[model samples]
Target: METDSDVELAVRPAPHPWLVLREHAHLVPMISLGGALGALGRWGLAQAMPHPAGAWAWATLWTNLGGAFLLGLLMSCVLTVWAHTRYVRPLLGVGVLGGFTTFSTAELDTRGLVAAGHPGEALAYVATSVALGLVAIMLGLGLGSALLRRGRPRRVTP
Candidate 1:
């Protein structure tokens, strides 16, 4: 014997995949544009400050740190000031910042340093990058939030 719950479940039709895709179709272009702009910025930075193999990847380190900072700031804005702005997070946080930060390149650089008999430098690079990245993100979040607070109008007490 079929229960009422079973009957209800059977009566409800599943949503079509195309409809789901169409709902989020607008986000694709925003992400794409942000990613392209970020990639170009990163490429320009790398070109300006080229680093050879087995050396400290200053460019990658700075790029990742900058991205992390920006992501934190963007998140603060998104959660507070831009809460209703649907595309802001996808465009800036996921696309632009994602493209700007290169984890693979950082790993490759670390490996190259290790292979080149500079294990100490590799360890230092990795440690400093991770530590600094964390600090940078925290700083970004704090600064963004503080700036937002300052900009907000305070209510006067009677």
Candidate 2:
């Protein structure tokens, strides 16, 4: 299996501006679908497990972080197991999951917290989320890196 640097080198040899957009196009509907599902799931979660303080803020945080973890897992699987197709990466990963979770909501939540005279808590929430989100991604990536090693295509009989 290639090292992280090698994995990147293998894939990053070419550059394409339009390619990014194209990838997004593939992922748009998937992202939209993920968003719909995620929103509904969030609503259910919120109802089932209401936050102690800020309902919206907590819910949004939960959703985004959850989505990020899911994304990490998905990307790892697709890259390692499903063998990402041209359409899958952009549409499913980029569009659906990216759309499903949000940074904008997090920003809005922080803004609300500040406006409501809880700057300290707001900052704390932001900090905690950022730290946790990154950690979650790292965990996902670590798991994925292992999958990458394991999923290296096996030899086929001629």
Candidate 3:
């Protein structure tokens, strides 16, 4: 025999397609606006800071590291203190940070460094970027989580 839980599940109506779309309708605009601004900032940085010959692309490296850190912090804040806010995660984490970080440009920079007779620099850049990016994320995560915990209400046990 079906239990009450089973009966309740069976009687519940599935959400309509229109309702699903409406639920996520805000994502498009939020992501779009954040992405546009993020991309524009990246482009402006690239233009303003030209890469030196036979060396690392400091701009891209900085961008990726900063973006990764921001994403980690954003996620921590959203999942903890700002959990009640719906759109902050999508707009900042997915839209802005996603657009700000450029894997394609990073790869191109590495390749160009190698092609420009700087294989050592290319390897160093790649290694440093990956290593530092990981560290940035970890640092951001730790700091954000600490701040979140500090701001939260603590329970007093008897």
lDDT of each: 0.89, 0.72, 0.86
On a 0 to 100 scale, what is the lDDT of residue 51 in model 3?
80
Task: Tell me the lDDT of model 2 at 135.
Answer: 82
Global Cα lDDT for candidate 3 = 0.86
The alpha-carbon deviation from the true structure for residue 28 of candidate 2, after best TM-score superposition, in angstroms, is: 4.9
Against the hidden reference, what TM-scores do the models get?
0.84, 0.64, 0.77
Candidate closest to the true structure, highest TM-score: 1
After superposition on all CA atoms, how large is the RMSD of candidate 2? 8.1
- Scored against the true structure, residue 14 in model 3 reaches a CA lDDT of 88
| Arranged by TM-score, best first | 1, 3, 2
Tens-digit lDDT track of model 2 for 1-158: 64676444545456587887685565566666755765666667657656544434777788778878877877777866678466666555765676657778788788878887888888998897899888877787788888778868888999
Worst 10 residues of 1 by lDDT: 2-11
**Per-residue lDDT of candidate 3, residues 1-158 (tens digit):** 75676445546778998998798997889989889888987888888878876567888998999988888788788887779987888788878888888878888999989999989888898898899999989888888999888888899999
lDDT of 1 by residue, 68-111 (tens): 89988988999899999889998998789988888788889999
Compare the candidates by lDDT and give the number of the best one.
1
